[model samples]
Structure formats: structure tokens, C-alpha cells
Target chain A: MRAHNLALVLDTVATSADPPSRASVAAATGLTRATVSALVDDLIAGGLLTELDPPPRTGAGRPAAGLALTSAGPAGLGCEINVDYLAACVVDLTGTVRQHLVEHADQRPAAAAAALAALGRLAARARLAAEADGLVMAGAALAVPGLVSAGTVLDAPNLGWRDVDASALLRGVPELADLPVVVDNEANLAALGELRVPGAEQTFLYVSGEIGIGAGLVIDGELYRGVRGWSGEIGHVTIYPDGRPCRCGATGCLEQYAGQEALAAGEPRAAAALGIALSAAVNLLDVPVVVLGGAYATYFDRLRDGIEAELRRRVLTAGLAPVTLRAARLGTNAAVRGAADAVVREVRDDPAAWLRRVG
Target chain B: MRAHNLALVLDTVATSADPPSRASVAAATGLTRATVSALVDDLIAGGLLTELDPPPRTGAGRPAAGLALTSAGPAGLGCEINVDYLAACVVDLTGTVRQHLVEHADQRPAAAAAALAALGRLAARARLAAEADGLVMAGAALAVPGLVSAGTVLDAPNLGWRDVDASALLRGVPELADLPVVVDNEANLAALGELRVPGAEQTFLYVSGEIGIGAGLVIDGELYRGVRGWSGEIGHVTIYPDGRPCRCGATGCLEQYAGQEALAAGEPRAAAALGIALSAAVNLLDVPVVVLGGAYATYFDRLRDGIEAELRRRVLTAGLAPVTLRAARLGTNAAVRGAADAVVREVRDDPAAWLRRVG
Candidate 1:
């Protein structure tokens, strides 16, 4: 009961626009004030929460003490291995990034061990910086630019890696050896990062663009990994049959049309192709929101008009509710941040598990 | 505890290949023999379950008295208003079709009242047959060839229906006046029927073809009705960039290439176009199975070669697990059977509700 109530209080505090007081938490959670106070004490002791000064009141008998998430508390470590770079970051319990680093290096030609070693170095640096800031490192997760299942990279065409154990790659580093390391697709992580944004739509698609195009689906604020965690391969979605050949050996694939290389090279049809493809996605999934990330986010201003025009022409429900297209706020940093946030999500979803181990 | 145990017993009996006795049910559900017996008695009295004679055995100390769903118990009524036909069926607790009827009628040009009136006649015929067989009609659901949400047929292009109050259309019939009717897309119902098949894949796409190509997604054996239930619009997916115009106004759409009219006319490009489109779906969703329904199933033998070749070439997981393509077992009857089974599914998912209503 204590663990459950603690979660409830944490949720109420996390969702409130302003810092909530013990009384407010009790009222919101239907728990007694005494129980809320006891739970808050336990949470504060565990470094997951903190009490704040009373807010300046306009009209009140007495200002209630405010409670909020601790700034320098248990933090999560996140890393991402992309085709052109490796990134790592540390995020606190309040979803704030404390330390981050990105190393740009062409990874496609590098050996799997060498690329993983470089990524490990970046992760270690972030971890050291996080420790210096007086934050306890909780857990770590890695985002890979490919299909991943059970912490193993099944296939990464851009990285030239296949069947590599991603968790094993991180185990070589002593700082992360004891920590649980989860491996998932980078696009999926990016979507999770967007979903965690305050006041973001609960259901939307996050399209990530690099040399290749991929998408991550968030349904009801939870990332949908699909069976076997092999979903979000939108790059291979056929666009124009007999139009352009893709590296995946498919003709007229979306990647051949809307990929970073295609758009950057001044292909006149790139944005239009993206729009036509997105129309199919909207019609098939019935999701009303789409967030462009990575290169797409960076170049969204240039491509927005063409994409919207295509949507207006192809989308069946364009008249009912115009599909909302927006640029991803985090851009290139989203994958790494999402990886770190994924680690934090574990504790947020089940605080009792954290309490069992730490309390 | 009694209500929960009753549901468990019904679930176990429904899933079991052979009739299970009270002892077996107790072991399966972790309930005491007395508890199982008491719940079984209530279910039997409610006419939801019945005792069956033990199967003849060559050697046994004593035979266990078996239990099974009663054939003459409460049943579900299913009706379908398609582009070319009106169908209705009654399915009992055992998942057996107790009564069925079908009438050919082109619904596109017909007035809304006229089409609904014809559908009502088909529903009445099935309800009467079910009553003659001593089966109690539980509920009714109608499958239309279009988008549906909130028990309303929002739009059915082939049928030229928009903002149709389907339940109100059936309310005029005396037999169904008191029965609550559900309205949904035909493809969605077909997918539900496929999901209910014994040993069916947990996640798959069911493609229903007739005049247009519509799809239903079943993820983990439940229909994935999008937020507003406007999913599975596969016909609108673009194929050729500047090809023949579709009724939905998109140029070079899949429906123009692979719809029933195209395939039936022996267009050589139809099967190939279907393959290219399905490849996109497989890559995007990573659902390893695709079930072809309606005309697609009837003509599977002819389209098999082209579809298989495309899947082999385009599916990313072709090296890991080749995407399996199979014909829907229920074929033409899938929608009607699914509509009836859907009503039965409500009770199967919660047999205690049926027990409460009757006992």
C-alpha cells in the first residue's frame, strides 16, 4: 500500500503544472494527509523527491509547502550508436539532461568492436560527468540504428553490423558492467522521447531521418515496439513503383525518395514523395499527428509546404481534421535523451521496485 | 470469486479440444473441486453449459463426467451489409453457426432506407431460425463496407453512406427493436473472424477485397480499431505515381490496380501490384502473417506466384522469418460469422455477465 501510494503521489506531483503540496497530493490521490506525508518523507529520503519553499500566495489563509522532484538525485544513462556518430547522455529523475556528448565519426566502415568501443568511451565520459554533479547513476540503455531484440542488434544495414550483442558491447566498460543495459531501435527511442514531452499528444508518429528514414509509433503515450521489436521500418515502404531503386533492393522505396541524401542532393521529388508516403501512413494508422525528427526536423521549414500540400490532396479525412505536422524539439539529441529517459521510465512506472532495492 | 471462477470455467471449456470434467477445470483454474462444481452447476442451470457423456475408453478405472457449452444456449446475431450482398447469421456458445441467410443486392445506388430495410429482412430471417432452434438471441452487430465509429456508419464509399445511424435503421424491425446492435467496418469484422480461428497467428493483416482493397489489422488476436475506428484503408495506398485515377481521387492508387474489379478482369498487373503494396505493409508493420480474404482468397492460386516473389525480395526479415501468406479460412462468410462471433465474444470474455443476466 505504501509503495502504491508513493507512486500515486509521484504521479500527481509530476503531472501538476506547479509544485504540489502534501495536502494537494492527498486530495488528488484520495489518500489521507498523514499517509501522504509519511510517503513523501520516504520518497525524499530516497532522493527521488524534495520539499520546496511555499509559493507566494495571492489569496490564501496559509501557503502550503510545495513538493517537487529532486534535481541532484538518481539519474539514468543513455547512449546511441548511429551511422555517422555515437552519443551519450545522463538524465535526472526530473527528466533533465545533466551531461551529454556526441562524437562524430563515420561508423559504416568501422569494425563492430571498434564502433562499440568508441560508443563505450562516450558513455563513460557522460557517466563521469554525471557523478561529478553529485547524482547517483541508476541504469543505462542504448539506441541502435537498426532492428534490435533482446539487447542484440539483429541487423543494421547502415552500420554494417548483424547479430551483435549490444549489451555485451557495453559490458566491457567497468562503469556500466553492473548496470542493466537495454538495446532498442533509435527511432523507437526518439518517439518515446517525444511522447514524454510535457503536454504532447498521447498518440502520434515520430519520423526520424538520417541517411535512411525510419518511424517510431507512440500509441497512448507508450512506444509500440510491435511483436519481436522489429516495427517502424517505414524506410522500406514502397513509394513510387518503378521510380527509384533503394539500397534495400526495392524500387521506388521511401528511403530512395525522402532519405537525407535524396533531400540534401536537391532532388525535386523528395518532399512530394514524403508527403504522398505520409498520406498512406495517416490513412492506414488513423494517427492525426506526425513529428519530423533528425534531418527532417532540421529541414522541416523547407519541406513543410510540399508535405502539407500532398496531405491535402491524398488524406481521406483532410476535411474532418487537418493532420498536424511539427518539428521535433530535440532533433539529433532525441535518440540519446530517449535512451536515458527509457531507463528512468522503469523507475517511474514501478517505484515499488526501486523502493524494494533502495529503501 | 464465484463470478471470476465461472468465467474461468467457460474460458477453459471453450479453448479445450476435448471436453473437460470438473476435476480438470479445478486443476486448470487452481480452484477447489467444490468451487468448480458449484460454478458449473450455476452455469448449467443458466443454460450456458451442459454435461456430456464420457468418451468411451479402452481402459480406465472411472470415466470423468465431461462438460461442454450447450448448443441451444444464448447465441449471438450477426449481420453484414456489403456492396453486393446482405448477410446474417446466428452463432451459439460453441462457436457453431446455428442459422444463416444471404441475399444478393447492389447497395451502392440503393437509398439508405431501402438498403437497411433489405438488411433488416435478412436479420429477421436468421433471428427466427435461431429461435426455432431454441437459441436465445443475445445481441446483434452489422458489418458495413466502410468506416464506422461509435455504433455509427460514418462513411461507406462503395455503399454511398455517410453519417448513417445504422442502429436506428434496424430499430424499425420488431424482432431487433429491443436488441442492441453494433455497426462496424466489414474488413474489421473479417479480421476479427480470422483472429478467432483456432491456431491463428496472434498478429496478422487480413486483406478483404471486393471492388476495393480493404485491410483489417489483428494485433495479438484483437482487432486494432484505430482511435476513431477509421483504419484499414489499404485501397488508398499509392502504387504508381501517375497511373489511373481512383474513386478517392488519388492517381495510381492500389485499388485501381489490385481491387476485385481489376483482378477479375484478368489484368496482368493486379497480382504484381498487390505484392508491391503488401511488401510495404509487411516492412512498415513487421507483422509476419497476411491473411487474404474475399476475392483475394478465391483467386489466391493465381496470385500466389507474384505475391510470394515480391515478399521474398522486399521483406527485411525474409532472411530471419519469411512472411507467411495464407487465404482466410472463413472466406466470403467471414464478415457475417465475425459479426455473430463478436457478440458471442462479449459473453466469452465475460461469461459472468451472461450468468447474472440469466440466473
Candidate 2:
């Protein structure tokens, strides 16, 4: 009960638009002022929270000290392994990115071990930079463009990889071996990153367009990972059904028409195909918004009209509730940032665990 | 807390495979035997439960009496409005059907009021029959093949219903005015009905193939009703962009190829189109099972091969975790039974509410 109350108090302070005084948190959470103060003290002692300087007195005897998440305590290390790039970032407890690094390379030709080793080096650099800024690394998460489950990449056709043990590969790097790591699909992570946008909807589909198109389904503020963690394979959704054969042994998959290669080749039907596929998602899932990320964000100006035209015509609820479409605010950085945010969230969700570990 | 404990105890008995003794329920729920006995007594007095005769014992001094839900109280009234049929049924608390009636007629040309009036009369007959069987009508639920929200049928294309105030129409019928009613999409209700099947997967996509194609997504034992209750419009999912025009003002919709009319016309591409559209759903939603209901159940053997082939070929995780396909167990009766079941569930879930009302 104490742990739960501590987390509740911390979350209250973290999510408040303005720093909240202990009394305000007590009122908001329905906890007594004494209980709130005790919980806040524990959080402050654990370095999970800090009391902000009191505001200048206007007409009162003394202004209350506002509470906020500590920025200089713990941070998250995020790494990304894509077909063409490796990136890493460090995010602080206050949801601020402290360090970011991107390396442009054709990772498709590299072995899984080599790719992970490079990512390890980049993550090490980001970690050192964060440490220099008085932040300790809490944990790490890796984003891969593939079907990831239990720290293994089941398949990434674009990277010519399958069943790669990502955790073992990362463990080989001495700098990353001690850091706890979680692996997830890049699109899923990107969706989580977009979820942190100030005014984003709690439920929407986040489409990641790249060499292979993938999607992340955010339902009621949580990523819907599906039964086996292989949901949102929108790239493989049938578009033409017979127009073009796909490497996945499927005919006329959406990727064949609207993937990065197709869009680069200026495929005339890419926008229409995307619209058709998204319409199916919206109709079936009733997700009211679609966030276009990755290459789609880059080409949103060109694709928006064609996609909207098809959506208006194909969606059943268009007249009553139009599906909103928008570009990814974080653009190419969503996946890495989302990975870091996930680690930060883990610490915020269970500060007791972090406190116990540190103690 | 008492009401919650009452519902929990009732649900435990209701879902138990066999009638359980009060001692067994106490053990299962971690409540004291005295508490269980008191709750059971209240439930028995409220006509929600009954004590079964003890089984003959050889070694024991006394065999404990078993508890079961009462069959003679709080019956549910279910009605379905479809393009070709109007059906009503009464289901007792124990889930036994006491009465059922179906009228086959083309309802598209009839005004919504005329059609609902006929349904009200049918429901009244079923209710009277249930009353003769010693059951009291608790409430009613009506299922329609269209978009329903707030007791209004918004756009049932096959039935030519748009913005029809279903509650108002039913209220005009004195027989049903006094009964509490809920309006739901037929496919959603049918999926709920199928959820009651023993050993059924809690998450699956139920496709209802009538004159129009609608789908119900069940996730984690609950229906995934989208924002505004407009979800699972599988009929509008684009199949072959620009292939064929549809009455919903869309081109290449799955309904254009796999609807009941298309199958009746022996459309050669019906099976293939169904496979493609279902593949898209499986890919995006990652629902591991697909239950074909309505017309699709009748043609399951013919459509299974084509749909499975496409799912295996198109779904990204088909090799590792193949999507399972099955036919609806209840067949055409699923929607009406599900509607009735919904009402019965309401009573079972909150027996205290009913007891208060009756008192």
C-alpha cells in the first residue's frame, strides 16, 4: 500500500501541467495531506522527485513548495537498429532528451552481431554524455524493424535476418552487458513515442513507412502487441490481391505498392493503396486517427490529398466521423525517443523497484 | 462492498462447470463460509439461485447441497431485425431457450416502424410463452444488421434504414414499452453469443455474412466496440481497389465479392476476395481465430480452403503462429441468442439491482 501510494503521488507530480504542491496532490489524489507529504518525502529521498522552490509570496504567509520529477537522477538509454541506420538516445526522468546520435550505414549487409555491436558503441557514447550531465542510466530498450519477441528478431525481410538472438548479441558488448534491455518492433516504439505528443489521441494507428511499411496500433493509450507480439504487419495487408507478387509469398501486398522502394520509384498508386489499407484498419478497429511516420511524414504533402480522397470515399463513417490524418511530429526520431521513453516510464511506474535496486 | 461480493459469488456459481456447495464457493472466492451462506440465502430469496438436492453419500455423514442459478426467474427477451427475417426468443436465467419465433420476409421495402411493430408482437408472444413456463421477462435487446448508437439504427444499407429511432418505434408497441431494451449491431451480438461456447477462444474475429458482410472483434472476452460504437464494418474494407462498385458508394469492397448475393450468384472471385479481406484483418488486428457466422457458416467447407490458403500466404506470422478458422456454433440463431444472453448477463451481473427493483 505504501509503494502504491508512493507511485500514485509520483505520477501525480509527473503528469501535472504545472508543478503541484503537496496539498494540491493530496486533494487531486484524495489522499490526506499528511499521507501525501510522507509519500512525497520517500519519493524525494529516492531521487525520483524533488521539491521545486516555492513561488514568491503575493498575499499569503508562505507559498507551498511545488513537487516535480527529478531531472538529474536517472535516465533511459534507447537504441535503434534499422535496415539503413543505427541510432541511440538518452532521455532524462523529466522526459527530456539529453543526448542523441545517429549513424548512417547499410545495416542490411551487416551480421546481426556486428549491427548490435555498433549500436552498443553508440549507446555507450550517449550514456557517457548523459552521465556527464549528472544523470545515471536506469535501463535500455532496443527498437528493431521486425517481429520481435522475447528479445529475438523472428524475421526482418528487409534486413535479410531471421531468428536473430538480439539479447545475446548485445550481451557480447561489455559496455551494454550490465544494462537491462528490452527489444520491441520499431513501429510499436514509434507509436509509443507519438503517444507522448501533447495533444495526441489515446487511440490511433501509427504507420511507419520505410524499406518495409509497418504499423503500430495504440488502443486506449497502450500499444496493442497482439497475441504473439506480431500485430500491425500492415505492410503485408493485401492491396491489389493479384497485382504484384511479394517476397513474403503473398500477392499484391500493400508494401509492394506503397513501400519506400515503390514511393521512391514514384509508384502512381502508392497514395491510393495506402488510403485503401488505412481505411480497412479504421473501419475494422474504429481508430479515429492515422499518424504517418518515417518516410510517409517526409512525403505527407504529396500523399495527403490522395490518401484523404480514398479515405473519404471508402470509410463507412466518413460523413459522421471523419478519420483524422497527421504527420509524425517526431519524424525519423520517434522510434529511438520512444524506446528511451519506455524505459523512463518503467522507472516512473514502479519507483520502489528503482529505489530498492539503488539501495 | 456487499453488492460487489454478491455479484462475485453469483458469477462464480453461474460459471462453475457443476453446481457447487456454499462451502466450495467460499473456498473458491476466499470468503468466509458464513458470508457465502448469507449471500446465497439472499440470492435464493431473490429468485436468482436455488439449492440442488444433495447427492447420495456413502462415507460422508452429510452431503452438502449444491447451488445453481434459477431457471424460472428473470428471463431475457432477444429480437433480431435482418433484411430477410425478423426473429425473437426468450432465454431463462440458466441460458435455456423457453420460446422462439422467426418470420421470413423482405424487410427492405417496409418502413422501419412497420418492421419494429411486427418484431414487438413477436417478442410479446415469446415473452408470454416464457411467462407460461414460469419465467419473468427481465429486459430485452434488439440486434440489427447496421450501425447502431444510442438506440438508433444509423445506416443499415441492406434494410434501407437510416437514422431510425428503434427505441421510439418499440415504445409505440405497448407490449415492449415497459421492458428495458438495448440496441446493438447483429454481428456484435452474434459474437457475444459465440463467446458462450464452451472452450471457445476469448479473442477472435466473428464475420457475419448476410446480404451484407459485418464483423465483430472480440478481444480478451469483451467486444471491442470502437469510438461511437461503429466498428467491425468488414463489408466496407476495400478488396481490389477499383475492381467493382458497391451500394455504400465504395469500389472493390469485400461485400461486392463475398456478400450473400455474390455467393448466390456464384461469383468465382468470392472466396478469393474473402481471403484477401480477412487476411488484412488478421494482419492488422492479430486476432488468432476467425469464426464465420450467418451465410458464411453454411458455406464454410467451400470457403475454408480459399481463406486459409490466403491467410497462410499473407499473414506475417502464419508460419510461426497460424490463424485458426472455425464456423459459428450457433449458426443463424447466434444473434438472437446473444441478444438474450446479454440481458440475462445484466441480471446475473447485478442481482442486487433486480432484487431492489422487485422489492
Candidate 3:
């Protein structure tokens, strides 16, 4: 727990692009000067940070040395593997995406293994780029479009994956074998990516719309995985109990009501379907924000009204608060951005917990 | 905060019907001997607790003195004002309902004031009864049926109240004028009352059925008041959206679909309507418990299968855990019980925060 707090302190300091000093760190963290010094000493000793050129002493006062992250050491690798393509990026502890690579797979279920292999190639290319930059890749992050449970891909109709042991398959990749690979549902990873963004902290719903619609929720600053880690199948919940039959055998499921194809052909935007589906969700949790990504962003400008109407119904007499309905700023690259975030989490927990366990 | 904790300490040990010793308190709270000793001293200093003859030693140590609540000081009070009647109770900080009284009102718009006056008389009688037992009530609580907004009764259709300042009106009753009186929706209070019951901490959706259909959500050990303090209006959210104009000018509200009148008229249980209503609530919070109360409890058993089946269609999935459904143990007295809880809360907050501002 203390290590995690210290890691947070490190993140707070490193992410402060203004550049932080001892006094600033102490002020920002509300920690005593002594405590900040102790933590900073530990961080420097670990080689994660180094002394910077001292600030110019304008007056008859002592000069203060600044701190900065070192480009040296093993960096983290983030990879996004979808049905049609694979992408990987290597990032330094400071969240810089130093290296990136991409590949495409033939659109067929029979080519899943090749797709994964293509991901390996992308990861290797990114790793090589990092090494060229004099930074060794420390760990690997693999994100997939599917129902992921504890690092395993349960099903991915879009990718034709079923009963796939994601952890095992990724473990067999030569470059990733020596480097730990963390796996998660791409939507969850994307939500984390967005959450880590400088200013998106309030509880809200995140909907990822690629071939399928999946949702991830952050409530009161924590990700709510729900009972089965699938609390957010906004795609499957019945919007119209008898409207249309879905592949999952449910009639009028939200996917059937508002999937990418449905919205692409329908009168309203994807946000409308999300709005109707989430009106109930928002009312229940009182979440006031919705972030849309993937194909849905195409029709969001058109569907804003429907979403707002549903939101209005669930709110109190004071009316619903204005919820941000912004399109994913990173667009189609959300999955890759999410993977990068996973890498950061890994580096934070990696040293201690990783050292405590082995397969 | 400390009062409630101390009450819980005494109430927990009080279950044995034996005075608790310092060792027992330490065992109950999982606190160290020194901490429990300190708390016990604080309780003693506040005159809320007393010491008794030592209980016979069980193990191999010196006999330990027993601790118990004193016969003096503030206690809990709850009052529920229904359309036709009023019920009141005085409970201790430990939740023991020492006195209960009830009065019926004449069926008219102006009769509510008369009913309250009668309630005051009954309250006085109860106080006389408590005086017989040497207990002085510290405060009072009131629950109303309405869309209560910032201490104003926005509307209580059944009681013919519109824009009534209930807090100000109730102040005319001198017995309660000097005492702190807490007022809230009956459903919210009932949920709190149920929460205070031993082992009811598991998440539960509370349904109150009287003049209207009301729901209270307890998620993860906290009451979710929602955005406008006006959430849980299950009665108002449109169910059919196209069927039956509601009193609130909406079409197909849950109450319109599954209300008592609808049920008695043999409206084939609209599980879809109710399930959709609650599934939306459950999806947002992801809690796994539901309890039915008031007039609705009698029929919840009959509608369980249909409710679960409908919920399965929209909320529950193949592997996600199922939310448990139960009837409230307090039966119809939940509002009164909740009132007692409100009293406990009032006495617990920093007393200075509660002390009326002196002119």
C-alpha cells in the first residue's frame, strides 16, 4: 500500500510538466518536507529519476536542483490486437511513446493465430525502436477486442476467438516471454487510458464502438468491474424486449437496437442508443458524464438530442446536469492509448509484486 | 460519528443480555485493550455509559468490570405520517424502541394538520410512558409522503399538499420545537431502518408501497441520494412510454404499470415494466440484493419468478451473480425504524454543528 502511495507520488511529480522541485512536490502532496525528501531519495536511488540543472539563483539565495526521469532503463511495451490489425507502442516511465509499429491481418477466423503472430512482430519492432533509443523494453501489454476475464479471452465474435487462453498465448511470444504481458478487454483499457488523461476524473460511462459495442464504467474514482467482470455489456441489455433478434439470441438487445451497423443505417446517432441505454444506468448511479468512441463518434453530432432527452427523464426536478458527450479525442487509436496506460500501471506495480511471484 | 460508534459498541455487546467488560469490547471491535479503554472512558465522561459489578471471570485472569448504557441522556425518535394515519416511536441510541404510538386522521386536505396535532398528543402520552421508566427523549424524527425538496414539500398528491414547508409547519408543535426533528421521505427512512438491522449490510433495493410506489437503494453500505435528492422515484420513470398517461403527465410509469390498483385489477404482472425499472437501477449500482416492503411485500412473493425472468432478459447474464430478493423483516414499521436512525445520526454529528445558532 505504501509502495502504491509512493508510486502515486512519483506519477504526480513526473506528470507535472511544469517540472517539480522538492518544495513543489511537498506542497502538491501535502506531505512533510522530510517525507518528500525520503521518497525522492528512494526514487533517485532506484534510477527512475535524476538530478537536473540547478535553477538560476536570482538573488543571494541557495540554488535548487531539479529532478527529471531518466531515458535509461527498461521501458514498457503496449500492444493492441484487433481482428483486422495489430499495433504496439513502447513508452518511457514519463509516458512518452518512444516507439510504435503496426501490422494488418487477413479478415478470417482461420487467421487469428497469424494475427497474434503479427502482433508479436509489431511488439518486436517497437522493442527494437526503444533499444535504438537506448531504452530496454521492460514489459509488454496486450489488448484485445473480446470478453476478457482475468487475462483470458473468453469470446470475441468479431475476432472469431473462443476459449482462447490469452495469457498463455501471449506468454509464448518470444519477446514477451521474458517480458511480462498484461492482457485486458480493449474497452476497459481504453477507459483507463481516458481516465488517466489530465482532467477526466468524475464518474462517467465509456462506450467503445468498433465491430461491437462494449462499455466500461468508472464510479466515484474506481472502475466497477461488477460481479462477473462484465457489468458493462451495454451492448446486450434489452433496449426493446421484443424489437429485433440478436446473435446472442436476445430480442431487441441494445446491440441489435444500437450496434455500429444499426446506428450506421438508422435515423439517429450511436449516442442516442447509448443515451437511451444509459438513461437507466445514469439514473441508477447518478453518473453525469458519457464519453463516446469508435464508430459512434461519426453519428454523435447527430444523436445528441436523443441522448439528452433520455438523460432528462432520469434526473430530478432540477433537470440533468450538462454531461460531456465529447468524441474520443484520440479517435481509432484509443485501444493503443489504453495499452500505454496499462504499461504505466505495470511499471508502477511491477517492481515489487512482480518480484514476489513467478509462474 | 462517535456516538453511533459507541452505540454500536454497546448494542453489539448488549446482545448477550450481559454487561460488556473491557475485554469483551476489545474482542467485539477488534480494537486493542488501550483503545477500547480510551473509548470506554470517553463514553463514561459523556454520561452515556456506566460500570457494573464485575462479571465472573471465564479464563485465568482477574475479574473484569462490566459496562452498560446509562439510564439518562438523549435517544432516538421516529414518526411516519401517512395519508390517513400517523405512527411515532421513541428508541434508544441502541435502537431499542421503548415507546410506540399511533393516531388516525380525518380524510381531508386540512385533516393532516389535525392528524399532526393528534400525533403530538400521542407523543406526549408516549413521553409520559417513558417518564414512568425514567427515560427522557432527546429529539424527534418525521417522515412524510411527498416529493420533498430542500425542506419543502414540493407535492404530496395524496395529502393535498403543494409547496408546503413541512419543517416550518411541524415547528408549531412545542414538544418537538426545541428538539431536533429530522424529516425525509418514508421510503428513504425505511431503507435506513432496515440497514440498521443486524446483518442487513448486504446491498438491497427497498420497495415501499403505501400511497405510492417508492424505492430506496442501499449500495455498498451507503445510501445513494442521487443527483437531486429525488432519485429512486421508480413510480415516475416511464415503463411503456406509449401506454397510459400518468398523473405526472408521463406515459407508462412503473407505478402505472405495477401499482397496487393495477395489481388488484388483475393486470397480468407486467414483469417487463418492473424488471426494466429495476434493471436500470441495478445496472448503474451493480448491487446484488432487493427487499420488498409495505403493501408491496404481500405480493412480491407471487411476482418473484416473473420479476427475476424479466430481470434476466435485461440485467442478469449467464454468469453474472443474481441479486437476492427478500421481504423486509420490520414489515410496515420500517419508516418508524428509519426515524430512529435519523435521530441517531443527528446526535452523532459534531454537536456544535447541530446546536441552533444563537442570536
TM-score of chain B of 3: 0.81
User: Worst lDDT window (10 residues) for model 1 chain B?
Assistant: B151-160
Best-to-worst lDDT order: 2, 1, 3
Which parts of model 2 have CA positions greater than 4 angstroms off? A21-42, A51-66, B30-35, B53-64
What order do candidates take by DockQ, descending? 2, 1, 3
Candidate 3 residue lDDT tens string, B1-359: 55555555655555657787888888888777887787677666664567887768788978888887665545676777776667888776556788888776643466556656666666666666765776656667778776676767776655676676766566567766676666677888888889988888556778776656777877666776754455567666545545676555445567777876677776784555677666655644455777777766777777778877766656534334666767887888888778876786555443322222220
Fnat per model, in the order given?
Answer: 0.60, 0.86, 0.17
Query: TM-score, chain B only, every model?
Result: 0.94, 0.96, 0.81
State which candidate, 1 or 3, has the greater lDDT: 1
Whole-model lDDT values for every prediction: 0.85, 0.91, 0.67
Model 2: which residue pairs collide?
A: none
Please name the candidate that would achieve the greatest DockQ relative to the true structure. 2
Predicted candidate 2 versus true structure: per-residue lDDT over A49-104, tens digit per residue: 98889888889588899899999988999999888789999999999999999998
Cα lDDT tens digits, model 3, A254-275, are 6775776677677354554566
Query: Which of candidates 1 and 2 reaches a greater DockQ?
Result: 2
Score every model by TM-score. 0.91, 0.95, 0.82
**Per-model tally of clashing residue pairs:** 0, 0, 2
Say which candidate scores most in lDDT.
2
For TM-score, the strongest prediction is 2
DockQ of each: 0.60, 0.81, 0.28
Off by over 4 Å in 1: A1-9, A16-42, A51-66, A170-178, A351-359, B1-6, B16-42, B53-65, B351-359
